[model samples]
Target: MIKFAYTILYVQDVQRSLEFYETVFGFTRKFITPDNSYGELITGDTTLSFAAHDLAKSNLKDGFMKSSNDNKPFAMEIAFSTDNVEALYEQAIKAGAIAEKPAEYKPHGQTVAYVRDLDGFLVEICTPME
Candidate 1:
């Protein structure tokens, strides 16, 4: 017996990541601890958990990793599906995120681009192409 649902990614800075998700992807805050050590963001049924780097490592194999990693040319980016692409893209730019590629409509029916969050995670925000 097994259930399929939910995902949690290790984030570097809780406030920074919270800002990026809330501003860029329009995720609402589920909860934020006063110490800024733990928080959760919700977009519909999706739950994004943000745990402090120091705490995260301790939870690992005797604190294997000390910090969050900046996925460069290796790890896959997290893709978020949205109804509005351009608006979110612009908002992300205003939020101090660096956009590697400007948003563009594709023949494959997607208006998409990539933006780097505070921790260097690539986020792909997209909608159907025009």
Candidate 2:
């Protein structure tokens, strides 16, 4: 069977990115390399990982677009489902995440909000779909 294990975001600073996720999302740290170029967080069944730009460049022959707050967010986003969307949204902003939208109820009865992480990655905070 095929299963999704983790998603790695290429970031300028792996340690900083890992810390941001831990502080804003409350995910515990799994480990970071001694060089601080790569790290992982124990985010439930699927791990959330980060690789430094330099490390990622070495791994991929071709370069990739870098995320930046100055630019519009990418087409994709990482969503977190939570019962307390308002509280978490507030906390994320306070923890340095840029608020994209405030929590609002959708016609489907879900509460959703958006924010950009330090590296400009889109993050969605929302209520679980019923």
Best by lDDT: 2
Model 2 spans > 4 angstroms off = none
lDDT of 1 by residue, 67-129 (tens): 223445226677787787777877888987777787888878788888776666677888844
Q: lDDT of each structure? A: 0.73, 0.94
Model 2 Cα lDDT, one tens digit per residue, 74-110: 9999999999999999999998999999999999999
For all predicted structures, in order, the TM-scores are 0.78, 0.97
Report residue 10 deviation for candidate 1 (angstroms). Answer: 2.4
Per model, how many backbone clashes are there? 2, 0
Which 10-residue window of candidate 2 scores lowest in summed lDDT? Answer: 15-24
